[model samples]
Target: MNRFLRTLCVLVMLAVVAPALAATDVEAVKQRVAKVDVLRGEFTQEKQVAGFKNPLRSQGRFVLAQDHGVIWTTLKPFPSEVVVTRDRILSRQSDGSSRVELDGRQQPAMRSVNAIMFALMSGDAQALSAQFTVKVEVLPGNGWKMQLTPRSAMLGKVFAQLTLSGDRYVREVQINEANQDVTRIQFAGMSDTPTTLSTDEGRRFE
Candidate 1:
């Protein structure tokens, strides 16, 4: 083929391939996040109130199971653990006391947390779409970023947005919520499959 013709053909091919590749990457990101079952990691949480003079900082370990729930345990700057399940929230303090908040039966904020947990566990894009305008962007070096903005007024008041970033190995979930609260969690060491929490652990939040 002529040089010009060959170059033209290559360009046409790239034009078609590029968009398909981009769409595939977007789907891959969704799939990658959906497949995560159990996630255990260390995290740094920073909270800024609307009128606070300083941001509160804490270090913690996070445990999440797709079926059972999420346990956020803060070990530094005050020890506490928040266990979340389908039914309720169990918050335990370093003093060995616990408070339980019922699921849909509780306050608005608790219900919101339950909704978030359900969405995370189900990986239901439709459910999430109702509350968040989500976009997935693949970054260089095989990394990805999923950004979510609140679609509802209530969600907006509670959670401003969330930006999650991670690579091919395991996904890192970073949550940026209302009032400048940020949770940066990286999942480095993971099991081959998602694990299920015991009945007791799952009911700890009840």
Candidate 2:
């Protein structure tokens, strides 16, 4: 299909799906999730690549400080850390040296990368609505599941869909890429106590 036709198709699909989305209280789910200002948890991610027989797996612990940023420490396969903040994404080696992977000072659009990660981890549905047509399903025991489909031709070329579900906090996220690859992440051992960051963890943000 031509580019024009593809664009038209997406517009038509949104026109049909918009009403049902409006009727759902997805904002409430966002509010519930946003209550946590600080949280720490362990995460396991599996990435299934196209044509690859085995999926790549990694285990990590994460600290989400709404005031600062997120710290993802990968402990297995390779020891490293990725810090996603409002200004840049910092990558650190196991030995403690780190570098800025994407700096918004050099490229303003790099901020979008920051926004996307914060919105996803912080459950800011309104932020995601800018790029995706989202559908929210309320689950038993106050849980909720959301599926996001790309809204633009550019994003549609990269992501087929993204599904996320959680109760008091986000529990899992599954991403479907346009190339038939899939990535799934699950969270466990979440806690909000001991709100203060450790000295070492605090230095990572510097």
Candidate 3:
């Protein structure tokens, strides 16, 4: 796999698993997520690998539509876009050339990745529990924190743990990999109102 896809796969996997949580708390988290139909935000991402002295940094904007899926556009450190839907994953370069594309029907893993990402973004805790052990904690103020550990040995070998913190929507994601690599992503300027998609953004999904 390419660097981008590999990184994305790991990140998406992180979104799907959690430790263990009380039934009520889990339900609460789900309710909070259910209120959001569309999510738009900007993100800063830092990635640290064993041999690098400095972490790689990237800035991006993302839109997650409940019906259309996700459109992630990275504008800094080189331009690229990744569109992930229930049936396909498409990657494009700054020049608008295709980098990679995967059909879920042809690839089971792709299908699972899509499902997991939707569940995570939507805060469908019950769906996540089917795949991972989940633990939830109330934060100091208004938010909640969640930790996810993979159930499959194969997945465990890829990620040590994934921690997510947020109130009504996901605010931060921290990923610890078994290979000693780490990634942290912080999100800001989020909104869910005006749930409709623009014409250009809608085209990406098709």
Candidate 4:
């Protein structure tokens, strides 16, 4: 074949193959996520504002176990923590004040965290779909972004949408709420960390 013709054929082949390769990668990521037992990482939450001259922000790390549940422990701008366990939710402030929500029915914020964690751990699209419109997209470097938009009038009252970024392992999450408030969290080195809920860690939250 002529050089120009050969080059043209190669380009056409790549154009068709690229998308299929991406889809395969996305499916593989989903499969790996479904079987994940634990995930741990450092995180930072950046809250943004447009109208206000100042913006609010926070930082944290998280440990998530599929069966045991989630922990969001902020380490910056003051130390604080939030835990969502199988039975209850716990929040401890920097000033030593603590709040507990049992059976997932105490605070709206707790409920929101629980809902998002459930969707992430269970890989249940329907759970999120009940509240948010879900769009799964292929991200750069074989990663995935699951964007969620609130469907319920009640839910939209608190937040507008949420975006979860990850690969075969979850790497970051952003919860974009109403009032121009945005919480962006980036997870680092999750796969290497152990996320088992030991007796000592469990007691600390309790």
Candidate closest to the true structure, highest lDDT: 3
Candidate 3 per-residue lDDT, tens place, 1-206, comes to 34455566764443222211222237666554435556677888888997889998989888777677777888999998877777888878856866788788987755765676666555565676666777878765567888888776645656788888877667788888877889998888887667789888788777
lDDT of 4 at 18: 12
Best by TM-score: 3
> What TM-score does each of the candidates earn?
0.70, 0.77, 0.83, 0.69
**Stretches of model 3 off by over 4 angstroms after superposition:** 1-4, 11-25, 31-34, 121-125
Worst 10 residues of 1 by lDDT: 11-20
lDDT of 2 by residue, 94-186 (tens): 777755365657754446545554555455546667777878788778788888887867667756987777877678777777778787878
State which candidate, 1 or 2, has the greater TM-score: 2
> Could you give candidate 1's per-residue lDDT for residues 103-173 as a string of tens digits?
44645555664665475456554665676676877777767776768788765655566666666433454
- lDDT (0-100) at residue 147 of candidate 1? 72
Q: Rank the candidates by TM-score, best first.
A: 3, 2, 1, 4
RMSD after CA superposition, every candidate: 15.4, 8.4, 3.5, 15.0
**Residue 93 C-alpha lDDT in model 4:** 72
Question: Clashes in model 3: which pairs?
Answer: 17-148, 18-133, 18-134, 18-148, 19-133, 19-134, 19-135, 20-134, 20-135
The models' CA-based lDDT, in order, is: 0.53, 0.64, 0.69, 0.53
Clashes per model (N, Cα, C within 3 A): 0, 0, 9, 0
lDDT of 4 by residue, 76-185 (tens): 78787666664455556745576534454654544554554455455554554466675777757767776667787755655577666666555666666555656565
